[model samples]
Target chain A: MDILQALANGFEVALQPVNLLLVFVGCLVGTLIGVLPGIGPISGVALLVPLTFALKLTPESAIILLAGIYYGAMYGGSTTSILLNIPGETSSVVTTLDGNQMARQGRAGAALAISAWGSFIAGTLSVLALMLLGPLLAQWAIRFGPAEYFALMVFGFSTLSALAGKNMAKALLATLFGLLLSTVGQDPQSGMSRFTFGLLQLEDGMDFLVVAIGLFAVSEVLMILQDKAPPAVQATVGRVYLSLKEFTFSLLTILRSSILGFVIGVLPGAGASIASFVAYTVEKRLLGSRARFGQGDIRGVAAPESANNAAAGGAMIPLLTLGLPGSGTTAIMLGALVSLGVTPGPQMFQQHPNVVWGLIASMYVGNAMLLLLNLPLVGLFVRLLAVPSWFLIPAVLAVSFIGVYAVNNNPFDLLLMTVFGLVGYVMRRLDFPLAPVLLGLVLGYLMEVNLRRAMAISNGDVGFLFSSPIAIVLWVLAGLSLFAPTLLSRFVKRGALGDDEI
Target chain B: MSNPTHRTDRIVGVLLLLLSIAYGWTASRFEVGMLSDPVGPKPFPYLIAICTAVASLWLILRPDPDPQWPPVSFWLPLGLVLGSLVAYAYLLVPLGFIVVTTLEMALLAVLFGARWWQGLAAGLAFSLVVYFLFTAGLNVPLPAGKIWGLGR
Candidate 1:
């Protein structure tokens, strides 16, 4: 079916009572989590995945809820960055540079209002792009073969490794660690056992949900424990209603950032963090001497917020088309999909058109839902921010434990969950990237299955991995991605970190 | 904080290097006699071990490192939290849900630095809410004890 017809069908599914309610609940939960310091959409989705799993959701309904959280959290994250001077994650860091400054200058309401509107604009635009671009990419990706798919996975892994780490060696090590973790279960082909340490639990390997929640959520809790910043008190809280003039003035900045975000988002390794940075720098360069730029500029808040939201849409490109996730959030989405027995790749668009198109269609409706929910209810959400951290901690822990238990009606999973959580906490304390671990857990089985299949096909030929042109190209790119970090850091430092600043 | 952070990183890096070597040694013990394929399951583990060792070495060799160790106060609380979790895992089956979870939550709250009564009350309330939500509302099963008829 054409994109229009697919979208129409998606709307039919999305508008149902259950799905719409789920979308709304997902958005609210997402925003709340996004507003929380240190927690991002990645952990937000991971922590919630068990709930959805236990809730017995249809795959379509599940995707709608998860995707809604993915995008809606971006919008909520902008709020905290603007008002509290604390960005929830790296993506919102740029928003804080101007946003918090604006708050200090008494334009908090205006900045908040414009950010919400800018998000709405970029979000709506990206949905239209998703409707058009996703189908096109799906059609083109239909030509891929096993060798091509293997190369694509390699490319995906390389891109993420390079993007994730501070240097090439670190990225390589991270990627290698991921590949190694995949070897911890019974060999898919040879039936040879690996790394199981004689434990029966290791036979099934690690559950991605366990790894994801433990690494992201548990690690996050540990990180939060290290914070010296006091729990945020409401600061000059007010309604977030934009003036017509204010909206019009920031419209151009929003447009520029949206396009910039979309482009950056489409790249394999570049995520919202990069998109926001690029958008902010470009806005500064374009504004030149006319604007304050970082000193409480309205355009400053608008640009990054719009770019980040648009980038969320852009991040989906590689995932839907190539079965590769570009950011941590998308990685969790990938995990969620895998849990539902869906393997994402070029063929996924053809095989699961409803999931792809329905998710795309829902983004449009979800954005509208967030914009409506965020405006008048801004004060209400900010008030929620006032709930004691002590209370929130226990509540969240309880819910997470309950969700895991309900999944299998087993306390063993809950124990496993806690163990992983402790492991996650330790990893975070050491500054290790949690993303690699999640990537490892999810992709380990697939990599093994494919490697075994390829080996069997080639009949013990070592050169089969490099025999294909696609494989050769991918290997070369992977090699380059190992070095890309050092080169990119130099250019990024000049524009992003400033020459003199840390 | 900075000195401790760097010191800890160096210690952790060295430990990881040692761990990777052990992993490599263990991996080498997996026998694949005359396997037709050039690579096998063992190859992946050895490769990972090598990479881990190399990365750990690199981290150790760096002169200046992030000079921020998490506070001992923070870490101590986390340790208690983890200890209680382990305790809960072992005790839950024997003692039942309410008794074990109530103890777990209470202990965790105190470890998180809550005062005694406050921690006890909070833990009890949290456990009760979970019990009701899971068992009553969701109709999911929970362990019932002989005494409470619900927590075991």
Candidate 2:
């Protein structure tokens, strides 16, 4: 009863005309970002963080807008994959396999329709799951002490590092690198400078936004320069409607993949890309020679399309409930949340239920808006694909620079951003994961604070970290995350690995 | 970078190791001022440095196969693009938001293959649009031009 009452109040906040309009605009821009190749939700939201602050919207409205963009992007991401055989983003990479196959056979209409429908169904289902599950998780997390929090974050970093980049070593290095960056400012507890290198600007610590926009958005511009532009492709959506038989065929696939994806997404480090690939593989094995997986099967489009959207919804559970961001985009969202003057954690649900539920309720409305928008306007987004890399890439960079400058009006941050951009570009080429560095940076301060707090509480007894059963469980999970991938990786293609860290 | 060998990994490994050592060395010297908290700020940095050292040592011992870098020619233009950003940083106050942003975008357009005048027009249009959005809609202040003695 309390849950329904809270969600209803959330609906009240979300339905305000201004909030509705923000969500609509967020969805529209999000789809554009998704339809474009070489840019993803991380860059899109990273560019918006400062703008959102400058706009002076309430934290609830800001979150609603950003959340709209996050899922709306998942919707638009499938368009290029189905039409051009180019995934709009990494999460939709699997869609390219079967999505393009359908397009080539003149069934692009059915593929697009089915994907929209599946995304709609799974998105709604996963939000429902989040609604039911989020409060429960928060309640459990409310009992955490500093020791439990420390152990839990260690678990998060371990899983993320092990599963993220080209190899565990590179990923761990990125994680350590991020932790080092987080320690640059004066230590809050001791008031001692850790690694300021004597720079006065660093007293407040490295701003995550400057680094993120620089690394993800600015580097994307430099990256486009290295490769020639995508050649113009000839493709069309014939009818944009799925036959009843096609609908029935993919319905079961959508439901199954949505469930599978939600569970994968709820894990600490696992995200949409993994859920989609694993769902596709599982469907392939389930069909056992009856299903055509890689060559434009309807179920192929259904599996990843729904799974990724559902995973996006599922990924939010940890972020809202536990203040843990499992993937890169969510980490950026976490940054947005922090900037909005909202601390994300167990208390968020109780202290700012309007922000919490408003965001949740907005996703439902946003998903509906996306289904309507995608059904008719797939052509509009596809036309946007013609935007030359020369034009779009520069525009994106301009936004990154301007937005970072707007945040503090500091040119030094701009220089710092450029440095990170080059660093990000090189790291990508070397196959070092970028997300863990972000994850480490975002989570590092909290991890250090909690570890120090636990140590203080325990009077420097190292055994206190392992003292609690919850802490023990978290440590064990951390170990499993490091080892489980090597054991379970045989099921996935090597191509489907690594880059999913996004 | 030109040769395309495992040495990229080794070089990166050495750099990381140096960073680890540098971090560790600096962290070890922090004077314990508080003596209030049971464990001061030193342990976390030590943990991070040690982790980096271990990871970098592994990378050094067992380097991965070579990853091919983009063509060497990429450096000049890449530098130009990155340079434009840094230049825009210092120049924004002096040259103004409109002038610096226009130049940055135009440089990007021209570098990626556009006519200079077209790039200029496009850059001006985009910069003006952002200018209007910020000043008119959000009521936010942006530097006009310090040398011109414009809006403070």
Candidate 3:
């Protein structure tokens, strides 16, 4: 079926009373999680997966809810950054640069209003782009061989490791560790247990939900405990609506940043954080010395907010079309999809049109819901900041613990989650990027399956990896991604020092 | 400024190197199936082992300067939180979900510096609400207490 027909079907699924209620609930929960520190979209979605299973909703509805949370969190994330200067997630880090400044200047309402408007516009634009691009990419990807898929997976890993954090070595180590963890279950090819350590639970391998909760939720709780409590939020939020002049001034920046953010989001491993940073920098460059860019500039707030939301939408493109998750949150979403018995790939649109389109339709509904929720409810969310971390952190932990336990009705998973939580804590302390580890875990099985399949087909000839044109192109892209960071940094350094000095 | 750079890096590197060696050694013992393909399960683990070894060596050889550690005040609370989680895991199935969760939440709240009554109230309220929400509303089978039949 064509896009319009599929989307009409999707809206039918999305607008069903149950699905609509779920979308609303997802948005509400997502905003709450986003407004609250320590729990992000990853953990929020992870924590809810088992609950969705318990609810026994159809896969399409479940995904609609989860996807709602994913983008809704992006919208809610800016609230804390603007009001309290604490970014609820990595993507909101750039928002705090000018968002907090605006709060301090007592323009918190204006900043919040612009962020919501920018997010809505960018989110809508990106969803439209996804509607256009998703099918085309899926059409192209249907022709990929196992070798090409393997190369693409490699490229995903390399890009993630390269941009995951400041330390490439740490990121690489995390990726390797994740790959190792993925190898814990029975091998799909041989049915040989590689590292089950003789537990029956080990037979199924580590649940991604457990790992995600431990790594993201539990680790965050520990980190929060280690720090002092957050300071009082700035409460002088003047005028919840932006003036006509201010809105007009920021329209171009919002549009430009949205496009930039969408492109970055489509790239594997380059997520909202990077998009926001790049958008803010591009906006700064465009403005020059006309305004103090970082010092409470409304354009700075508008640009990053628009870009990050746009990027969230953009990140969905690869996931929906290629089944390759471009970011950590998308990785969790992939796990959710797999658990729901839906394998996302080029054939996903053909096989699961309702699910793919319903999710797309829900994004439209979700973005609208968020735009409404955020503007008027900004004050209510800011009030949540006063809810003590002591109480909030423990509540998150309790939810995580229960969520994991409910997955298999086993306490062992809770213990495993705790262990991973500790490991996540250590990794965080040592500055390892958590996202790469997650990416590795999510992609590891697929990578191995494709590699073994490719090898088997080629009669164990490793040369086949380099033989196909698509495979060769992907391999070259992977190589470039792996070294891109080093090359870019060197070039940046040289540029900073000027040609003669270099 | 007084401290040497990369103290944590050197320690982590050494630990990772040892882990990779152990992991590599363990991975070599997996039995290859009779009908297994030429590239078996061993290649993936071996690759990971090699990556870990190389990365750890790199970390050891060239550690990042000016690594920041959490302050002294952080350790006690961190330890408390960790210990409470472990305890919660052990106590969960036996003492039941609601009871253990309540205790664990209260303990964590106090550890994070909440007043006793405040922690107790928040923990009790939070645990009870979540328990009912999951068990009654969502149909998740959280364990009823063996000691007292509170959750069934």
Which candidate would rank higher by TM-score, 1 or 2? 2
| Model 1 chain B lowest lDDT segment of ten | B143-152
Runs of candidate 2 exceeding 4 Å displacement: A486-502, B1-5
Chain A accuracy as TM-score for every candidate: 0.92, 0.96, 0.96
Q: Which stretches of candidate 1 lie over 4 Å from their true place?
A: A407-415, A487-502, B1-11, B31-40, B61-64, B111-114, B139-152
Per-candidate TM equals 0.90, 0.96, 0.96
Better of 2 and 3 by DockQ: 3
DockQ of each: 0.41, 0.72, 0.73
Poorest 10 consecutive residues by lDDT, candidate 2 chain A: A493-502
On lDDT, who's better, 1 or 2? Answer: 2
Query: What value does the lDDT take at residue A58 in candidate 3?
Result: 84
lDDT (C-alpha) at residue B149 in model 1: 46
lDDT (Cα, tens digit) per residue for candidate 3, span A1-502: 5889989998998899999999999999999988888887888988988888999988898888898888888889998899878898789999999999998888988999999999999999999999999999999999988889999888888877776777778888888888889999888988888787888888888888899899988998887777665765546566788999999999999999999999989988788988988898888878899867879999989999999999999999989888899888999888888988999999999999999999999899999999888888888887888877888888888888888998888888988898889999988887888877787898899989999999999999999989988888889988887776667767677344221211
Best by DockQ: 3
Give the Å error, residue A406, model 3: 0.8
Model 1, position A257: C-alpha lDDT score:
93
